[model samples]
Target: MESSRNLKMKFDDLFDVLVKDLTENQPADTSPALKWFQQVLLYNVPHGKKNRGLTVVQSYEFLIGEKKEMSDEDFKITAVVGWCIELLQAFFLVSDDVMDHSITRRGRPCWYTVPGVGLIAMNDALYIESSVYKLLKKYIRNKPYYIDIVDLFHETIHQTIVGQCLDLLTSKEVNLDGFTLDRYNAIVKYKTAYYSFHLPVACAIYMVGINDERSHQLAKDILLKMGEYFQVQDDYLDCFGDPELTGKLGTDIEDNKCSWLIVQAWSKADNRQKEILKVNYGKPEECNLKMVKMVYEELNLRTVYEDYEAKSFQEISKLIEGIDSCLPKTMFNEFAKKIYKRNK
Candidate 1:
C-alpha cells in the first residue's frame, strides 16, 4: 500500500508538469479557445486516479531492473511520455461522455456539463488528442523505437474506437438473444483491455529497448490478461463496492453494460430470469436498479466474483513465473500484487 501511494504521487507530479507545460506553450494572448483548451486538458486529465500512466513507469522499472537506478533525466522523459497516455485517455473520455450522455465522471460534472463548456468539449477532446502526438514527438523522436511507439498508439486508438462502436451497436440492438460470451470478451479486449492495460505497459517496454516481436508479443499476452482481470474486478465492484469508496454509484445495470457480471449471470439464468433482466436491466429508474440488484444477489454474483478472482490470481502467477527471470520480475510482480485484491 505504501508503494502504491508513492507510485500515485509520482503520477500526480508528472501530470502537473505536463499540464503546466501545455499551458505555458499555448498562445500568450487570452482567447476563449485557448482558455477552453487549457481548462479541458487540466480538468479532464487530472481527475482520474492516474493508474494508466503510472503503469508505464512501473513496467519500465520492472523491465529495467530497479537495481539499475534511472537517471533523473530518464525518469523525467518516461514520466512525460506516461502523462501523454493519460492525456489520450482524457481525450477519449470527454468525447465518450457526450456520446454516452454521461453526466458525471470521477464524482464530478463531466467536462461537457460544465458551465459554458457544453458541445465545445468535443473540440477540447481533440486538443487533448493532438497534445499526445506533440509530446511523443518531443520526447521520443530520437529513440530508435519512436516509429513503433507512434504506430502502437495509432493502432490502439483505432481498436478502441472499433470497440466503442460495437458497444454502441450492442446497446441499440437490445436483443440479448445475440449476446454471447465470445462477443463480450471481444468487446472487453478491444475496447477496454488494449488501451487500459496493454498500451501503457507496451509503451514502457518499447522505451526500455524491448522492441523484439517475440518479447512484445509475450508482454502483451501477459498484460492483456491482467487487463481483463482488472476490468472484471471493476465490473464486480460497480454493484458490490461501497459508493463512498468507489466515488460513484454503480450504473452498469442501469446502463445495460455488457459487463462480465451480466454475461455470467445471463449464462446461468432461467428463461424467467432472463425475461426479468430484459425488462429491468437498462431502464433508468430506481425500481429497475433494485430489480437488477435483486437478481444479482439471488444468483450469488459475489460468489462468482470470488471464484473468478481466485482463478485470475493463479493464472497471473503462472504467467509471471513463465517470464524470463532475466527481466525485472519484482517490478511486474509488484504491479500485479497491487491490483490483485484492490478494494478501492
Candidate 2:
C-alpha cells in the first residue's frame, strides 16, 4: 500500500512536470496556443487510473529487481516515459470522444464537450501527440533505446488509428451480423491492446536491455492475451457498469460498437431475443435502451461474462507460467493481477 501510494505521488508529480515543460516554457508569442493546450492536457491527460503509464515504471522495477535499486534519476526517466504513455492515452480518448460524439468521460464532460472546445479538440489531440515526442526527445534521447521507443510509439499510434478506422467502418452499419467475435478481436487488439498493454512493457524491456525478439514476442503474446481479456471486461462494464462508479456513461450500444458484450449476446440469443435486439440495439432512445437491457438480462450475459472472466484469468495465469525465458514471470503476474477481476 505504501509503495502504491508513493508511486501515485510520483505519477502526479510527473504530470506537473509535463504540464510545466510543455505549457509554461514556450515563447510568449506562442502563449495563446500553449495556454489552450495546457487546458487540453489538464482536462484529458491525468484523470484516469494511470494504470498503463504506471505499468512502465512497475515493469521496469520488476525487470531490474535483481540488478540494483533504481536511482531517483532512473525513476524520473521511467516516469517521464510513463507520462508519455498517459499522453498517448489522452490523445486517443479525446479524439475518440469527438469521433464518437461522446459527451461524458472520466465522470466529466469530455474535452471535446467542454464549452468552446467542440471540434477544436482534434487539434488539441494533435498537440498532445506532438508533445509526446518533444518530452521523449528531451528526457529519453540519451538512452540507448531511444530510437526504439520512438518507433514503438509511432507504430502503436498507427495501429490504433487503423483499429479506429476499422471500428468506424464496422459500426457504420448496425446489423447484428456485423458484431462478431472475430471483428471484435481485431478491433480491440489494434485499438486498445498495443498501446495499453504491450507498449509500456515493451518500453520497459528496451530500457532494461531485454530487446531480443524471443523475449519481446513472449511479452507481446502474453500481454495481448491479457489485453483482449481486459477489453472484454471493458465491454461488460460499458453496458452494466454504474456511471458513478465507472466515471462515464457507456455509449457502445448507441454507437453500435463491436463490443464483446454485444457479440456474446448475439451468439447466445434466440430468434425472439435477436428480434428484440434488432429493434433496439443501436438506437439512442431510452425505451430502446431498456429493451436492449432486458434482452441482456434475460440472456444472463452478466453471468456469461463472469464465467468467461474466471476462465480467462486461469488461462492467462497458465500462459504466464509457460514463459521459458529470463524475463520475469512475476512481472507478468503483476500485470495479470491488476486486471484479473477488476471492477473498473
Candidate 3:
C-alpha cells in the first residue's frame, strides 16, 4: 500500500535495526573478530539491489492486497523476513566468491579480496549466515510460523550448499564432456534458484498464513521453474550481455563455466568448431578468448539464445497460469515480469 520508495526506506530502517541489534550482541569493543563481522556484514549484505529482501515485502503486500491497510508493526516484521533473505544471500556469495576466486561483486571488490581480509572472509560469511537466525529469533520467536520459517531457511541453505558443491566440482572438471543441459539445470536450481527465487516468496507465504502443504508445494514447483529460467538467462547474459548493463564483464568463457551458451554451442558445433573449442575454450589468453567467441558467432549462439529466451517465457507463463486460485497468481506474475527479458 505504501509507495515503492516508502517501502524501500522502511526496509532499510528495519535492516539497520537488525544490524545494530546484531552488532550489540557481538563481543565488546575493538576486537578483531567483531570488527571482521561488522565489516563483512556491511559490505556484502547491503551492497546489492536488495531485490530478494524487497520481494518478501512486495509479495506479502501483494498477497494480502495492497489496498488493505498494513500496520507498522506487521510491516516491520515482514521487512525483517526480507532482510533475512538478504543475509542468506550474503552468506552464499561471500563463500561463493572465495570458491570461484572472483575479484569483484557489483562492480566492487569481493569481500575476500578486500585488503587484509583474505581467507577470513569465509568465517565472516559464517557470521553473516548466523546473523539470519539471530534476527529471526529476536523478531519472530513467538510467532506460530517460527519453526516452519527456520526449517525452510535451513532446508534452503542445505539445498544451496549442495548445489554449490555440485557447481564447484563441475567447474573443476577439465573436460567439456560433462557439461550438459541437465547438469546446468541441477547446478542452477540448487545453487541459485532456491535461495534467490523460491525462498523469498515461500517466506512471505508462511508470514501471510498460507501453510497448506498443497499450496506450498505448488508454489515451489512454479518458482523452481522460474528460478531455473532465471539462471539460464544469467548464463546467457554472462556471455552475450552488455558489460555496462550487466554491471560486470562476462567471464564464464575464461572460467570454463557450465553456461547455457556453452552447452548450446557445444551441442551445435561441427567437428572443426568442436576442435576449435577444444583448443581454446577455457584458456585465459586473448587469442583463445577470440577463438571461442568466433565459434559462438559462427554457430549463431546469439540467435539460439533469443529462441531459448522466448520459449522459456512461454513455458513459465503457462506455469503461472496453472497456479491454483487459492494462491495469489499476481505475486508470481509480478516476479516473472521483473525477470522476463532482463538483460542485467
Predicted model with the maximum lDDT? 2
- Candidate 2: C-alpha lDDT: 0.90
**Which regions in candidate 2 have their CA more than 4 angstroms from the true location?**
none
lDDT of 1 by residue, 1-344 (tens): 22667767766877666766666766667566666677778788887878888778777776777467767676777777778889889988899888878877888888898998889889888889988998888777988878988998999999999988877777665867656778777887888889988898888888888767877777777778888888888888888887778766667777777878788878888888888889998889999988878888888889989999999988988887888634555656776887987876
Candidate 3 wrong stretches, greater than 4 Å: none
Per-residue CA lDDT of model 2 for 1-344, tens digit only, reads 22988988987887887899998867889988987988888889989999999999998899888659888887898899999999999999999999998989999998887889888999999999999999999998888999999999999999999999988998887578988889989999999999999999999999989878999999999999999999999989998888888898999998877888889889999999999999988889999989989988999998999999999999899989999988999999988988877877
- Candidate 3 global Cα RMSD: 1.5
In model 3, residue pairs whose N, Cα or C atoms come closer than 3 Å (at least 3 residues apart or on different chains), thus clashing, are none
Worst 10 residues of 2 by lDDT: 1-10
Instruction: List clashing residue pairs in candidate 2.
Output: none
Top candidate on TM-score is 2
lDDT of 1: 0.80
